[model samples]
Every structure is written in C-alpha cells, then in structure tokens.
Target: MSTFAVHLSYPSSPPGMKLVGKRYVSANAQQEGLPLVFTHYTGAHKELREPAIQKLFDLHSKRPTPAIRKAWAFAGNHGEAGVVNAGSLKSETNGLLHSLLSTLPPSSVSYRAIMFVEPSLITREMRLKHKAERRIAPRSCAR
Candidate 1:
C-alpha cells in the first residue's frame, strides 16, 4: 500500500485500491500532496502507436504497488509527471529503506542500485572512497 490516497475515475476499481498505506511520514511535509507515481519516459516513446502508450499506462495504473510504481517511471520532462516526479522518486526510496529497517534481518550486507543522469556531481573524492571500499564502481552520479 502507498502512503497517500488515490481516486481513479473508474468506478469499477476495487475499493481496496483506494486505500493507501498508513501516512506514517513522521513529519516530512514534502511527502504530502504527491501523486502516487511518475513515468518519466523519453520522447522516443512517441514513435509508438498512439494507443500503445495509453494502454500501457492503463495496465500499470491498475496495479499501484510501490515497487511497480517505481519501476514504471520513465524520463520525459512533459506529460503527467512533473515536479512530483522527483518527489515520487525520493518518497518511494524512503519507503524502501524504512521497510528494510523495520524488518529484523540476519547479519549480512545489503546493496542498492540507482540511476543518475548527471555527471557534474561525480568527483574524485567519491571515486576514491568508492575504490577504497573495494566494491564495484558505480556508473552514475545519481543522488
């Protein structure tokens, strides 16, 4: 379940779909008023047949699990997703981390992969620290 409520135009949608996760943001106001998902798709998708995009959106919108919402995100500056685009990314990430922490786990290492589209944030310090850790080098400077 998500942290916010959703109201789809379809009257046939299951009532359970309207229920969002408990709004346990713990005082982070930015977490409020954000749409449940953002598909930041590239313009290349425009090449697809017109109905294809809408169909895909409809398919995914039917399943509002947090992980699916995160995966459905694409990379375009226009369309349904706007500033809530970045906010959705941050909020979903917070949810993932919190879920992990809440679960007691066996002693082991955890890994995460992120995609960053910028390069200016990549610095020598980041490179050195990463190398010192002896882990695989990251390919992006995503924050």
Candidate 2:
C-alpha cells in the first residue's frame, strides 16, 4: 500500500525508466513487460478477482491498453481498516474503525495499521468505491 501511495504522491519516472513490476525498471523491460504483466494479488476474498483486477488497472493508469489491462498477477487489497462493510460496524471493529478514523485521515497507511499487516493469498475487494486521491504530504508530515 505504501508503494502505491508513494507512486501516486510523486511525479512520473524519468525517461527510459518505467514503473513496472512495482519498481523502476528500464522502459525496455521486455522481460518483465512482456505482452502481459503477470502478478499476484492477495487479500480476503476467495473468489475470482475481477474487481480487484479492474482496480489494478485503475490504480496504474500510466499508459494502459486493452491488452495491458489484462493483468496476470500481483495485488494486495483490503478494507478501510477493519470496516469491510456496514456489518463491520456491528462488531468490536466498530469502535476501532471510529477511533482510527478520528485520528488519521482516510489513507492506505491508516488502513494498513488497523489490519492487513501481513501478506495473504486471499483477495477481498471492498464494495465501497474510493475516488482516486493523490497529493503531496504537508510540511508538518515531514517532521
């Protein structure tokens, strides 16, 4: 998640450098950037990750094509902290989500804190939609 945040928080890569395979690789990364990029996404859902796949393309909209959009692997998704749905509010997660939200602005960092501290094979896509929001951290955040 931090990788995704850092990617959005900064400017694009330099010429000849491309954001492939989660790192700055040569634009000619033919090896990693074959006809398709095969990656793995892990999370909570136990079904085929269609939305998760779509969200992957949504997040990395650098120069996407229909074929390029056809992802093969690599994803790690979760909910806004412990709040996966309205039902989550009925459990102890209720108090936790409220407290965490009160303290941190809605961001992946905060979400990661409440849950998703480890990598998993599960893939769960939250039905809630979060419009893309990219920004520079405030100076106070630097300290």
C-alpha lDDT values of all predictions:
0.31, 0.29
lDDT tens digits, residues 4-95, model 2?
21111113222222122232222223333223332333343212334554554454454443222233322222232112333433432223
Runs of candidate 1 exceeding 4 Å displacement? 1-70, 78-120, 134-143
Work out the TM-score per prediction.
0.17, 0.18
Model 2 global lDDT (CA atoms, 0 to 1):
0.29
Winning candidate number (TM-score): 2
The TM-score obtained by model 1 is: 0.17
**lDDT leader:** 1
